[model samples]
Target: MSSRERVLAAVAGVAGIAAAATLATPGAAASGRYQHWDDTAYRGQIEVVRSADGPSDPTVLNGTVFVDRDRDSRHDRNERGLAGVEVSNGREVATTDSRGRYRLPVYDNMTVFVTQPAGYQVPVDEFNVAQFHYNHLPAGSPDLRYGGIAPTGPIPDAVNFPLVESRLTDDRRLSCIIAGDLQTYDLDEVEYARKGAIADLARRNDYQGCGSLFVGDVVGDDLSLYDEVKGLTAQTNGPARFLPGNHDLDFDATTAEHSFDTFRAQLAPAYFSYDVGNAHIIALNTVRYPCTPELDNADGLRPECDDPVNRPRYNGAIDATQLEWLRRDLAKVDRDKLIVIAGHIGLLNWADEGSAIHQVDQVREVYSLLHGRKAVALAGHSHSIENLRTGDSMQGWRDLFGVQSLPFPHLTVGAIAGDWYSGQVTEAGYPTALQRDGGRPGVLTLDLHDSSFQERFTVTGESDRVQTQLGLNSPTYREWYVARSAWNRNPVGAAPELGDPLVVDQADLAGGTWLTTNVFMGATGSTVTVRLDDGRPRAAVRTQAMQGEDQLVGPEWSDPVAVAEQLVHGGSVADRTMHLWRFALPADLSPGTHRAHVTATDIHGRRFTDSLTFRVVASR
Candidate 1:
């Protein structure tokens, strides 16, 4: 049969695959422009009773979590208080009593927030930002560049939190979106993001309840852009939540306590938790800015951190106070629920698998806390898509963090601003923005049923159908890579692109040539198989085994498809990835045009198929 016939056959075969039926959901299907919830739709807020003389007892703060029957931000006499709700002062977890009233010891500077319980939701402002927290910084933060938090004078008389009932939040089946690094440096980049992922999210209403948790780096160094970035979230169909990144820090703050004050003022609590369905999502503040030698384990490992005066580097760490809070927070959660531990920096990741500063320093301790619980960690500092499953290990994880292997899956959800939004601009109104792992910019959706979930990644303007990228790794491509990579470093002129990537000569087949498959979310137990036209299917081996092995990198391990775009245009080179798989071609094959059909079955047992045709000439 001709190559065109084979392509048609492969397309037809995909229709019969049972997994294809489960690809997209009705709520995920693109309707016209989604009508997002405006301010008039839900007007709820925490009732703060302030006094001219302030609270008599400054050490103790009292609050009530009440049912907002009138949809108002007040605690009316008729509206009853909700009991058994969780509240926090950033360090301690407090539960509401029988009457929904609770008292907690107050601190000088802390955010008192209520964890939006299942079956109900906290109030959202104009931008759909959940307003659950009340900052209690009496004197506020010290003088900082970004106007850190303005002085929130003495504690209010009663910080009454108002919550509204919602059937969406109570559903057993939930879809939670984990988006990383919107990281817009300027308004132009913001527009790129608006047209890309934000636009895609705006069209879907599936995640209206669980909403979108933007992991970190909301804006590049400009905290001034927080307002602009929050405006983009208004277009999305759900409540938008956030955690702070190194970029989101108020750099002028000399003390670490006030580093993220401005971020908390604009976005969310630095660390907080909420419940939806059977999932308990915990957003942690993992970035420790201006990490000095004074901190434990920072003396010798990081040189940039030595000079807090000039360098002022950030490290992936959880402070003692926050760690204590985590223990208290977990104590209140039911072990049956799925615990999603999210942060800006990964607890452990493939990109920085060996680096001590990039991965969280307290990973081992955090693991011990969730020892027997069902949990999954999600992060996005590295700008790579990593689906590291249970028992997956790297040399760095064992060496630095003392973690032998992952007890639970830790996923580095790829960034919204892919590779800092670099590469060629596409007609879709955004840059191609290919990631460091060769994965396209996308958001991760955890479709949960009870406590279990199936993770799916939807590319920014593409459907879930687009998952894998196909490429041929020939001996000739390697030679071009070395030459062009050097030229990219020190460009003399326009660097030449890879020539005839699909055409392999006799030398290429003899030396080494194979078909490479880059599965964006491939994890352990995931399998890739390649079938030549009319031939039996052969198994493809994963490049990085992720079983206590050091990272394997170089031209031989690179994705030719991603390298071509990065070297010619602009983006991080996809030199190493845990999700790459390859199938070696036989050297004894006759020279002719050939077609290969590739099928990748993920750990969730969902299968995705793609086909590529290449020419095998007798000689170059």
Candidate 2:
């Protein structure tokens, strides 16, 4: 459908609307994020008019947006209500009153939340999970394997949200963290999280503005690990938020409505938006649960299990309801501001580039709505680090999402629990968890300047300076790859086929050897140039041109350096990607120690230079 048709559909969604109370956030500054106000109120206290009485009354979903003067997290007798704070029910948007109060018509499973204003910080529990929402599910969820929302009986006299005054997020300059999956299946993996990325975040105070938005797959299939995930978040220096992933769902739930109840009860809303400075961040529930009757096999992509009547399959598309809700939400955002759209499943991807079910079906619709606006999308679920700039394209995106090319920057943030915490356990106690494309496990940050920004990736337990991974892709390495693939299919030795990785012989150079670098945030307009031993500079070629070619995969396309670590230590092989670049070496150069001074420049013109030295032997 055209963008116009989608808007008309959204307008049609506002149907069945009944007369309601005034909606407004009183006595607040008007500009940017929230301007117009609507009033809300309910009875002294709301009773869960029995499930038999039908869906909870829409108008009685009420709450307060107050100043927690003591930071006690509850409305105290002397605490004054802050006016003009916007509150929303995903569909119907409202604002607080002069008394810092709000009310909106709500149903059985609606999320009533406050879009935290700019100057004040929302209250975070010990785990740094922001307390900005109140879920209303009067009768609770039906019986399911993962326990969902317990009946949140009658509405309390007040569902109060506390905001503390802060100077950190008051302006246009902001640092928003877009972290990929931390798919920890057990407590041990949680420890890896603690020692790796969480520890790194604890050392910095910069991201307190937009905080950390863990894209998804927060945990493996086990919902029991939610608290441990919370424990990891508590270690961060700023507030943390989460969106649900395919693994984070209750697969046993009979219907879609209760799919993420437990997650909603423990984390932030399944989908929500907030603003800081000029950046408007929207977190979405991109994963659809029970995607297949069973699991993915080696033969093909996971089957669509979403047989609503039988075995349900998870999918990578947004439903009509969410599309309508997104339409309504974006309607409130300004045209010129930065819109950071985040989801678990990427809108389009290079990893799983062959699977149509791994990307969103509504990618085109979303692009249509966000066309005129300054936008960037961040996602997880595909464990690779991808920075797709405007005009970046791949066969899968065009074939699956129907998107010919990226309209704006679309990034696939690297995972925190890299490759499912695979590889060797470090002395630091974390696994190398090298991703499928060989990118290191790390997090991404968007340094916002008004509506535009520069993207940077920081390897965990390392500095921002550690931006690229250098490796050798030679005939020798390719031979080892063939052997390794065979051995992986059928074991041959204790150690894999990877030989001494850093060394290259005359034969290896004679056959052809290329120095490869995987720049984590490299994208279109980026340049990778090399100068050997102070020789003339030469530009390297990016493997995946992203101009509508099929994805290049397997050992032939793998990064030798990351492969060396992953193959021997046990993690994913970084064998394929769009950002890995290679520079051919001169075969006749004299046998001696040589250094390749490599310079990589990102789309933003940020240059990161690093040198790799290799000893060329006459014969080894």
Candidate 3:
């Protein structure tokens, strides 16, 4: 594959990933020519007064799936309905009739949504956000901290959805953006998002009709700020969809049933299914809230674990209803179609890696259900990016999930608000929130070709070609890291000791230094190699084998760039990972500047090339 080489001339003032590629400038003026839609479509709820009469019957949510011949979001006199499109209202599902009309039982605070059928497109707002659902909360949120949901007077007589004809969803290729954890906790963080990932997404046109799926943690506990985050998503050139995260829970709800009430009122179903071309997207609600002892008892000591009454807690498990719904939902989907399952806590991860509280308890069951299907799982909440290929294994997964190998590609697809959007602020108004894994904040795109696909991670403000971070892990840097880590844990007065980490001297070389490549989406079979000064390319060894071994951590396994930035700022340490490659630097090199061209090949055999120029000086 050919790459567009972006010279430094086109890269000035561009921060983060944008500075590394030949894409649009990070914060450039826009032409305002992206897909536009109705922001006001999200009708707020209305307070329903009880005078011995509230809504007693299931509100009739009737609608027609019409083909907008002229791309308008309204049914014209001559326009006809598109039959067989699936629609749902939280629980009970229904299909459009032959005449493109259908009705579902909707209750107060229930969202009536359509599972976008193949070969057709939904109406997208100005920011290319797909408008395919309606909020039906006659009485809005029962007043809480984050405002919850506003009141929608009464159920509409007819709730219709408009879709236009498009070849994008009909084609073999499905362009999907797996954006995990846009966890904006406040209004200021919302601004940071606008300047960062949102800016980068706004500049692209690849995923216009088919959208980006923000897996979880759309916000950081402040549900009222949802509109603020949605404002940021309005900049993308694709339809936007989301799954709920633990931070999105309605903490005031005493029972599990009402825990995600705010989330359901605001975003999407607690758990639902959708489709785009050949892929069947299953958005599951794996988080069981008020996760008291009755649910999550993995903590060694729990006397009242069986007590059913809810308390403030969260667990990683799917309830009977959701699981049963999943089975029934999958029963209808064609076996040949790719199953794209997404959630928040992740089926498994490397951060908590193998804790029972983090991974779902029914992973083996999920694996069993997906037997013989071409599938992949996407998740977040661990605040790290992980691409666990088929057959990949770790001790945690084996011990907790009771599985020795991954059945398919289970990508803990990083986070949009990387590391809780932590780190120092940038000129663009966003933080340089490098993730806990040392990866810069980013989104993952799955380029689907039939049942198979190529996964690509785009660092915010960076291009697709920018996939790896190169660093120098010298003895001096390692020592400084150790001192700094201790100082952080116990706070000493003395500052950390370290020199210019990138530059090496004779004594430093003798002490052993390595050139490290932190391949962002690298998996078990992925290989990274570096060639110095256009010389022979020596294969760089991956730090962790992911073969049932304990995670390899510390400075040797760390990404120097992430460590440097995160250590200065307040956030989780990027001390260990499943995707880092290192190469020992030659001590006998000539003392001038030299360029190292590194090539990383993913499991699918696609190559991403990156280069860095480093100096070998006498002193720093």
Candidate 4:
């Protein structure tokens, strides 16, 4: 039964069939922290009145109002004064006086929500914080299917807003499910990340349009499982965005700006930026534990060589005021449009084997401040699965800023705990063989479509199957199986066979490790070799260039079955988790059913081939 007794019997069968009045209390869990609120604990005063029967009259919409008594949209101080609570503006609805104040009636693309009241719970921001709906339109909204509130026509007298009661929103483009480190600090690795990747994002529907971005450690040091990671982002399918890793900070805070003050007060934007659609999405914090007093070694002194909490430091660096607010948010974007840049480390890598601080020093000054149009950078502290591409490496920053390489794409996106969530647990309840570079435990589905962008690697409950590439072992079978993989400790069972239907007699591929793939936008020269259907004559093995920690030079090792069939034809793992790759057939080949052809070449080079048939047999 263990996996922490099936996650404590699935949190005691979800608190004995859900609704313990919708659990939260404890002063709304100390007002959930509003992504770290400090706009000066907000005073109160609201009044956007105008419902005398339409055509404007009860006009009185001033502004600044936030208390949300634990409604969960984020605004604290033990969230009190809900007096009459009831706010709206999509048309009209008001209440909240006797100090809890309210007077609603305004519109310019209105959306002033607050209808959360069961056993009370609203307020979030240090990452546990939620509540955001006040778009104020000027001239947008008509793309339907959940893109709402853009049209800027009328309805505005005194449009004021300061709410604390929330369910989370901002006119909606939302479904942000990014997922990286579910680190898990026990409870059988949080039921092996809840039956391998939150039970497939809780029985999916294509992320329902913007809600999921685990992007950090989430627990691992056990901050009391932040309420069991908000009950696993409320069993997902939407709404859950958190960022902060170096193991989700708080090495007992005390300073270092209080190390994410308990996660900015529960998560909203330690660095922040959002747009969706034509895409913009930035989210950085980069782990900066400053701590002075000559770097307090708890007073024993002698620390400070740029104190990141007296150093154990993870790689990648950013601060300088978030690189000057990412150089004025990439100068208000539009270098033809398409920037993504998420974080947790990773700007360019052969998976940190070259470790210039685990990647991201100047990154060519941020790829010359992203001057060469079309971008897509994501990270997840190497839990593994690289994707790489574009001249395959000079170590990112688009080749340290002289630019060139990306004519238009970049990625790293892999880890829903594929490795940290480890292995062993099959009956399809999940978790079996996820060492990463080989793929599995997924999420990464970009699709921009205007300034051009495409990426897919969705695997968790086999949502159709998109995995780009990963197939290891070469280097003359690592010097003919490094001492029988240290006497069968299993270096992927010491492979090397190229005989029988597996004939590749002499391309002598020297000492190998990395072999990745995923190419679509127009592909190129794509000749991903390795074909053996007998007829005996194998030859494409050269060396020098791809180095170690399990080699495979970049662009996600050039082609792992064409990036796992473009992440299973781009449904992005239909929901999340499950994508595998593990090549090891060289023990001197001579068994049965062989065939493993994978070819691709486009950008007018045009060529395609896909085949997979296995059955080595004959061991005893």
Candidate 5:
């Protein structure tokens, strides 16, 4: 069978089993299943009440945001309508009147959705996926695989939205979870996600209000696994929302307009924004499938996308319509509130800092929109953790996108399905899936208080305290890295092991020895200091200065500790990272065991310390 057919069959098989299966919370009783937000007996749906003779005006669509006190999907006579609730038709924004009624101009191929006002909660499906939008496609999608959105005829006389009051979103302080790349290929990878990142989110109650916003790549090429993917979110504590990534596209589609039709029908609008606390979180769709030469702004770097026949590919871009929508969306947002811009691909990142097809093309326009306001960009796709601060620039960004420096902080939150779940399985029921930058599978959270926020990354099944990874980089290890890396390219036999990584000889130190620290979220203004046993603290220099320079890659900039695990077990090499810091070891150390303590201070002034021990022998 063809690969597409195989994917469809796999999706069909999983969907049947997923419908009957329940994702039990970790350590909870088998019978104790978490309840969905909109599992009412009345069948939760937007109350699209229509007149017997159809609507008087088809051009204008009307809606009401009502309080669903009885938990019914319908808006009862007694149930009052919510006032000043925001609603949109992808481009135009409208708010509910005093009577909770909102009217917007109707259009083809538009998604009508509510902003989900603060102090109120939107109902969720059985998979814990938030239900706040309705798709209106008059004629439906053209012939395509994965069956895009079905036809929804004329506009209803009234499309009322149901909501319930919640104190969770009312708080001024919010903890917003930004999970990246849950790129599960099949059912097995789905299980790994359930055990890894989903379990971590299930165990936490801190983000119930702002909820968990998964930043793209919800699955691999199999769009049919969306249901199985949604089942994982059923185990989490908050209303799960999602953004579209390159992997999440319906590749069978020919046009860019219908590229994400299946995703929008199943997950969310391609791009949208909502307000919570003092922050206006804008979720963007930065990926454009089948990018033609007319659309690509990569300065001919992405000639691969120019081919529509043999190799129709996706490019990191924001269409003119989406950019205009973003401008309109920002105008409505308060200037004092923090603007949290999120997408699948970053505006610019450390891993793909030099790749034009990997970063957004319209990033400069986006920066101009929030010219002086307090804003931060968050993204996935790179599968690396990067906490880049203002003024961080790269030669590629300067040459390709005409961007010299970052206007504000831009972060690439590490993926939950690290390196596509490519490593050995651990006792925790998940893969040791180390990322490209030597970071583990984890989720990022923005701890926001009013207009200010701090970013934190929690490694899967690990505590927040476990931030930095320590390793020894010596001449011996560098040689092992070169050998193993070459062998990894064309495997023939058992791989060469990095022996006694912490041990080094006189010649090894003389050739250049250093202690490497991979601070997962370390950025500019952050400092890494190392202290030997009973010695003064010595400063460690960051490998990448991020000051309009080219990427410093290879073994010299690698995290030896992480590379050891990846090469022996199986995963991406930690060859290059923007967060690595190295402290040169003294060559004249005595022939004995020595201890080194590492302390990394972040841009937020928060400090995390780790320690490692190594031996100094006369000869190996």
Candidate 6:
């Protein structure tokens, strides 16, 4: 018989038996108790409908549906067949047959969802939100920002599924895009972000099939924009996922644990794990609520922490339950596969004070869990670029937690809105320079091949370049120097002696200092020393040795106009800002010129040196 006809016959038979059971158990039925049937009651008879054309003409599909007696969302032991349960797709509804099977019509762009019964729950995504769809249109639909179901045709037959009464598990190789902190509080900024970022993704086919995931801080204090954020995401070519950050939490939430209630209800899973393509991705909720008692003070803020509004504080620590769950989850994963952990707070950031609480305190514990394997951790609260290549030993943890750095890598991904969408607008109608290192705003694409992964930062509208280290020493360096001097607290004085370059006479180099335009930062054992052409080497002092964060320190120019003029004319100046040094040579160095070379070695023992020659003028 045809699939549809077979489904009808099975349903007819099951209905007859159910009617007889109803009569036999009249007294027992009063309490809503009935003999649950096993899978054998309706073996291969039930079917589901599918169609390759469109939802307009769907075919029958053969599948099994069980009665979740335990009321858990998952299919578990002792759960019996829930025959006659009705499943539907707005247009058609079918009841489970004798074997707890049901045949229903399904179409692309159409939702074939089970009409969740009173005590039963449907499946939810990683965000712990119920799984629902607008519709499935393989070919896509209209241009609505939050596009609903597409108008694709019907799918294949036998698209039957099993629905249990317990929390469902979805372990699929998902391709998800992660965007950080779309913290748009106002409509204009929201539109700007949409025009710049949302518009860019709307037209792309790269993440079409796979959905997108926004790491956190979806909105500013104005939680009303959650819908607007969702609207923008709808414009994308795929589904969108979200995680909450400090800003996303409801400051007005009644209780500490309920801070993310509204967010949870709206977006789903707050913290969850999913598997995709040989990698296990875990999204954590690090922001705690209830500023009164303080949630563990992970950020080092005390119960009386000072804040104008006295709002709750946040830091990076999982609750006991979540921590336990994490340990269990990590235990289930294979060591050989990559484990990608993501959160709103970075393990390390340049924006925050050194060793902030938002940074993982139990980093060693987490690192130890994934020890001896390839893993990648990502965070985004800080809108900067920082890569920590902690060697195999987790030694860095010894001081903090008797732990060290793991062999794996930890990276802080730059924001989709680099520098809070700072800087001047470019020809592309977006901020071109938002990163501290002068890197443009964009997304990070990781390509995994077997056990290893290659990461590339693709600047918006540019080609992919795997290089992460930035190189500076040309005219760009000069411009930076001039800018630094113009903002310096000290200016240059009269000229110096024959062999001496411009020198600053002891000034406060504490704050707002500007050294030279050329800054060479190196890791431990890496040196950045400057030498005069006359064979006299200037001793470089260790301004700051930030094992946790990176910083640049040096001298500054008191007079900015002179520095700017010198920079314009390619002349020299004496200043230091952050980690740079500036110097102007004397006029009478044999009337010829001399060379000053600057060399830097990285932690890896790689050396780079650059030298510049200046023509010495005769003292007329």
Of the candidates shown, which would achieve the greatest lDDT relative to the real structure?
A: 1
Q: Could you tell me the TM-score of candidate 1?
A: 0.94
* Tens digits of lDDT, candidate 1, 95-174: 99989998888999999999989999888887888889988897888888888889988888889999999777777777
TM-score of 5: 0.91
Question: TM-score of every model?
Answer: 0.94, 0.86, 0.85, 0.32, 0.91, 0.54
Q: Comparing 4 and 5 by lDDT, which wins?
A: 5
Lowest lDDT sum, 10 consecutive residues, model 5, at 12-21
lDDT of 2 by residue, 220-330 (tens): 989989989988887775668899899899888866677898899888788888878877788888876655434322224445553555767677867667778788778
Give the candidate order by descending lDDT. Answer: 1, 5, 2, 3, 6, 4
Q: What stretches of model 4 exceed 4 Å from their correct place?
A: 1-62, 70-130, 142-196, 200-234, 237-239, 242-400, 403-437, 443-620
Relative to the unseen true structure, what is the C-alpha lDDT of residue 230 in candidate 3, on a scale of 0 to 100?
72
Candidate 5 per-residue C-alpha lDDT over 311-426 given as tens digits, one digit per residue, 9 for 90 to 100: 88998889998888788778877799899999999999989888888998888899999999999999999999999898888998898889989899998999999888976677
Q: What number of backbone clashes does candidate 1 have, counting pairs of residues 3 or more apart or in separate chains?
A: 0
RMSD of each: 4.0, 12.7, 5.9, 21.5, 8.0, 21.5
Model 3, position 602, has a per-residue lDDT of 77
Which candidate achieves the best TM-score against the true structure? 1
Task: Provide the lDDT at 601 for model 5.
Answer: 82
Segments of candidate 6 deviating more than 4 angstroms: 1-176, 208-210, 291-311, 350-353, 392-403, 466-550, 553-620
Candidate 5 ranges beyond 4 A from true positions: 1-44, 492-494
* RMSD, candidate 3, Å: 5.9
TM-score of 3: 0.85
